[model samples]
Target chain A: MCTCNKKNEYIPYPAKIESVKKESFDTKTFRVRFTDKNLAESFQYKQGQFMEVSILGVGEAPISITSSPSRKGFLEFNIRATGKVTDAIHALKKGDALYLRGPYGNSFPLEELKGKNLYFIAGGIGLAPLRSLINMVMDNRDDFKHVKILYGAKTPADMCFADELEVWKKIPDTEVWLTVDKPCDAWGCSIGVVTELWKETDVHPENAVAIVCGPAIMIKFVTLALKKSGFAGKDIIMTLERYMKCGIGKCGHCNIAGKFVCTDGPVFSYEQVKAFPEKEHVI
Target chain B: MSKMIEKKKIKGLLKEAVKQWHTYVPQKHIGGDVLIAPLPEEAKELEAALDNISLADDDLVISPKDIFFPQLETMFKFKKGEIAETVESSPKLLFGIKSCDLKGILFADEFFKRDFEDAYYLSRANERLIVVIGCINPPRPGACFCTSAKTGPFAEKGFDLQLVDNGESYFVETGSEKGEEFVAKYSGFFQDESGDAEKAVNSIKAKAEKAVELKIEFQKALDLMANDDFIPEEKYKRIGERCVYCGACVYTCPTCTCFNVFDNAKGDEGTRVRIWDACIFEGYTREASGHNPRNQKWLMACRRYEHKLKYDKAKTNMSGCVGCGRCLASCPVDIGMSKFVQEITEDKKIM
Candidate 1:
């Protein structure tokens, strides 16, 4: 057994804000270049894993890595200006410095989804992590079978990565659908919740993997829709969120039942979700 | 082997130990009472408080958890606008921990160091050496159930050294390599004589066992608590009603290791502090978006019990309660684990 009481200090890698782009009205995507270019080159992360973005005085927030590992040079984080830390992060500009701790937590098992028809569903800011995986699968298009992407936002202006979604829509054998809760006159997307488009697609449940992320209510309906449409528990995967203070699992904030989202999972199979006691209406 | 030290020599031993190491012992505090304070030179004139006083009936005056995991500690400090960091570490000795409190410390060690290790907690925990003072007398009124939990009067594991008071001197049983080193350093005060020491220790053990009023089948109580058997809603409410929400029970609990991390920053320089937090607090699990998994007092009460009886047991193979009785003492409304356990075990009526 390993000896107890080992002191492992968190090494802060300096990441410079290379550039920042406003993705939505309240959200921005940052492209950071690490001080040590080798560290940036060596940094490898699976989709759904998150990093601790620290603004020295403000504190750290676990943000999902938005850019795919396949597309690299620097890392990317799509953050919504919500709380104190995120608000501080929003004030940062190019040439400012930030500290990153990890590419922590279990990520999506892309290898498990290999050669299977994939259904990707996301709502609002939830598309951040899913976008990374979608890009990776698109790069390795021949390894995966049929692909379907259904996305939703509160409004047309609330949508993130619209240009990227447009590009994915042009890919062969990939079906991309977008929806808005409320539609404007110029909006060309479907006018309804993402769940409303469930009837428009035909998916093979036995040979498909469905990945969904969104607000708790939206994810609930999406999961139910997927289940009713014949996806088994194992074929469905999700990324769960909680108020995690310590990304190392000691602070006890991210616990659902006995599982620590930081250590045990942020990514879980629907079968595991079904077994959790707090399985009611979880996003 | 245990040996006798004349009561008069207790002061001298403490003084000598202090000269060599930073020793902490119980001392008279304000309010004309005693608490676990640093043993000063002049304070040694009084009799060793470890022997004269019995465990408090209401609450332990001080929790032993502080000896290892202090309430407020700086894990590391970072300078403003600079990425430089420095961690603080210190070494000290704890002198008068009781058997039950020692067990609680052991429980904390297991909890914090297992599965996903906490570097900050572990780093601070490594700096101390534990010296356990065995309980030779019965605990005051509120202290009974520790013997039932198999973690009282005397401890078998966790402590570096176990000291049993044998009227004239302490019978020191070295439990770890650190204890052996401690004995070696103080070899002048000890003599090798095993037979008499064994007899004295046995007599003391027998007296302590007879003095204990609390008795229970701990495994059975644990099993019942974990079982899906009906737990009356009224019983839970009665316990909740008695809770003043003071949070003293959780604060004093050695095994209650829940914490909250907050950043204390001024400009670009600050430190992240992990402070002790209890599940009973209103906002313990409150989300940034104002959602809480446990919003009611009854649910909080259930969560505490489940943590002690169900969660810790399943994870660590040990009951969370070391039966330290601090909760019983510190609680303003007289609600404690002992009373709760007694109610659950004896009152078949449930309410």
Candidate 2:
């Protein structure tokens, strides 16, 4: 309705929070739909792509789309209250209006993973982006050979999607493993870093692709573990996190080497990531 | 045959130009620095004006980049919950810009239009015409190195009109259709050369190219930096140690287009604006979770050079450095791209 794309990519469309669910102390999951019904219906995004979420007079931040396209009524964002824009977004109640501009960046290679074993590895809020792909894989369960989700958090309370985890565990032939760095009295799951779960699960590189999303340090160790587990660089996929302004790549803040993360990727195979000169800075 | 205009008629041309479009020319500021600025709205006699209007003789401390990609520009305005787009543009003429600065504009044009078009920059760029004045002598002799960068003493393309000074008059050549139209419209100011001006123009161009005394191994430096593992951490640390983080290089650079967006608000009404940003700052790459990839000063220094010499060349097939030498002129510390290239290829220390 606003014709934001035609007029200016910087001009964002108004959207309202349909609902808000507290995922953690600093994180909240918001279900948002465009204020314009037609625009909402037309908006489409893939698993790992992100949107530039704006809070009118505050600012904007890049938040990954957490909702799967298969369940496409509304978009969801799991935002952490870490900076000016995100803090302002966290303060907003249900039905509060905000602005959105993207669905920018490349998404996961879902086509290549068809009929192949899928391994999803995430830590803390890292699970947010991978959740989009995980749910899509679940919806079309028959299309995939196997599904394994290894998620971890700093603490039991920091773990997100607690109820959904139970639902996913009940899905036939799908495996969901969650761990916590600091477990509570009621906790019954394994405790340690995510790599510790490598011993418990049978993660084979043969005919399987491993998708990982987490903090840089966690990603580094996960990449090493995956490599040691006989996974090739091309078989290990990871999503990156960077401070970015314009999600359309005009803003050079997200640039590394000759690649712009906003355009070239938020998702890249380990083989590609290895080729970046400043890969150490990334993961 | 090319047109020619006497050096004495420059004031008259500018005076006439202001009447037609938003005209920018190098004017001496009260601080004694020359900057490219728009003519005052109120009409004034050019000869009688106290403000010294520099015409191809003085160094303009600031390039003409700010005319299109300003230091700060408002993207949109919002009141309460309602949002609106606020893009505005008007026809403009940039007169007496140096050749290096024109090349910078051309590079910026590609950068802003690549992949996704930036409406703000493209809108302003579409309404603009460039008039470059070729340098007969290096304006900043100590810092200017347009010869090695291969972008100047006179631009080969992208200018609307290029003027080469031949002492008594200027040999005018059109690089675009807009330039031809401009010459036809302002035929009174520009006239057919009275004599064989090609010889004079060629001689002046040679003299101007020779006046740029500073040269660096720009190509070899690019080749050295081509290897991703050529991490000159020690060199970067040395340069970073001397850097004041003043952001003078980026601000003065014609090709440094990185910007940070924020909102300026009062009560419920507010405007979102993007301001020029430097990558050397720690906050430029710092994430929301307090993690920074380029947190170190040396890393920041590396990024700045790698962007200009390495990444830009690989991506756009153009070096980001125009060899305008504003970086050295503006830097409190003498860390210019020419010096950096020298350090990379010749093993000379910048500091």
| The best candidate in terms of TM-score | 2
Candidate 1 error regions (>4 Å): A1-11, A278-283, B32-59, B138-140, B191-195, B225-244, B343-351
For model 2, the local distance difference test gives 0.87
Which digits, one per residue and each the tens of the lDDT, describe model 1 over residues B251-317? 8787887777567888667776668888777787676657665666776665677678766787788
Q: Each candidate's DockQ score against the native complex?
A: 0.40, 0.56
Return the lDDT, model 2, position A227. Answer: 96
Candidate 1 clash pair list: B5-B168, B5-B169, B58-B329, B59-B329
Worst 10-residue stretch by lDDT in candidate 1 chain A? A1-10
lDDT of 2 by residue, A83-160 (tens): 899999999999899899888999999999998998999999999999999899899999898888999899998988
Q: How well does candidate 1 score on lDDT at residue B10? A: 56
Model 1: residue B326 alpha-carbon error in angstroms: 2.3
**Clashing pairs for predicted structure model 2, backbone only:** none
